[model samples]
Target: MSDKSAALFALTNSLQPVKRVWRQAATQIFANSGISMSLANLVVIVNRNAQGINQRDLAEEIGMNPGAMVRILDQGTEAEYLERRELSRDRRFKTICILPAGKKLADEIESSANKLRVQLMEDVSVEDIENATRVLRLLEARASNFLQEHIHEKK
Candidate 1:
């Protein structure tokens, strides 16, 4: 294989273990907080945009389907973690707001995530981490551009 292909292969192989560690950590953290990973992620998004976020917008931002978002919202409502309030001017439009309980849970999840992140990077130097992040961002941008071009070409 060419040097570039060999490097890509090694990078792809490395990502599997990294992804596995993150998934395991997230599952454990969410379980301890009495929430699913999906719910915990949704709560974090809602809490960040606490002012007023439309359910549809939240779903789009999190790359979730509208139907799934509604189900997750329903579960959150049942758990008293979030509420959907009707807009006074437009009753048909409802805004999602994270409750105090949701904020508390978000905080806990963030704390646990941060600790896990630190643990994962404990052996890596700051400079190495920064370099890796830069390289990853560049790769992500290139991949995104390629996908967009390919998608448009197919249409």
Candidate 2:
């Protein structure tokens, strides 16, 4: 095989271990924090965007099934992690927003995650971190663009 093919294969192989480690760490943190991963993600999204965001739009952005999203929202409301209100423009649809409690939990968890990230990369140099961040951003942009193109091509 060519050098390019070999390098590509090596990069692909490297991603699996990184993904595995991240998943394990996240799962452990969530389990210990008494918060479900999806709930935590929802909190972050709502905290950033604020309450009264369209339920349908939120579900679509998160790639969640509408019914499943409704169930999650209902449970979150019961847990005092979120609130739902009917939109003035359309009474038929409800807007879901995260509560203060949820925001607190989300912020704490995100801080913990950041610390974990720092610990994980303790041995890596700042230069290495900068290069990695750039490479990852490029890869993400390319992937996002490819998906967009593929979607448009289908239409």
Candidate 3:
């Protein structure tokens, strides 16, 4: 690999183990709550949307398949954390609404995530973190554009 490619590979490769570790930590954090990371993420998104979000948008936002989104909705609905209601203007679409319980759980999830992030970021300077975030964002945009040119919007 070229030096730039090697460096990018190192950066991306290092993240996988950290991600695995965080998943394990998150599992433990949510052990008794019966909520996985994806479930918690769904609740957080629902809580953020003031008008509620439809199933398709929810699936896209969560980067999950529509069927998996429905399954997650089913789990949340059964747990009484959220509900899906048919939109008034669009009868065919159902918007996901976060119940009071879901709102509370979302808050807890945010708190736990913040705590974990703080722990994980220990000894890392704020400036360095910001720089890394900026670089990552730039790379993400570049990657998206590359895909659009080569794969998505193919000529």
Q: Write one digit per residue (lDDT tens) for candidate 1, span 1-155.
A: 99999998998788879877787877887785567777888888888896968988888888899887888889899998899999899998889999999989888888888898898789999999999999888987999899999999999
**Which pairs of residues collide in model 1?**
none
- Sorting all predicted structures by lDDT, with the top scorer first, yields 3, 1, 2
Candidate 1 regions exceeding 4 Å error are: 13-17, 85-94
lDDT at 46, model 3: 95
**Quick one: ranking by TM-score, best first?**
3, 1, 2
Model 1 C-alpha lDDT versus the unseen true structure: 0.86
- Model 2 gets an lDDT of 0.80
Error of 2 at 121 (Å): 1.0
Best candidate, TM-score-wise? 3
The list of candidate 2 runs beyond 4 A from truth reads: 13-17, 60-63
Better of 2 and 3 by lDDT: 3
Q: For candidate 3, what is the total of clashing residue pairs?
A: 0
**How much RMSD separates candidate 2 from the native structure?**
2.6
Candidate 3, residues 40-118, lDDT tens digits: the string is 8899899999678998999998889998778878989998889999988989999999999999998898788788889
Indicate the worst ten consecutive residues by lDDT in candidate 3: 26-35
TM-score of each: 0.80, 0.78, 0.87
> Clashes per prediction?
0, 0, 0
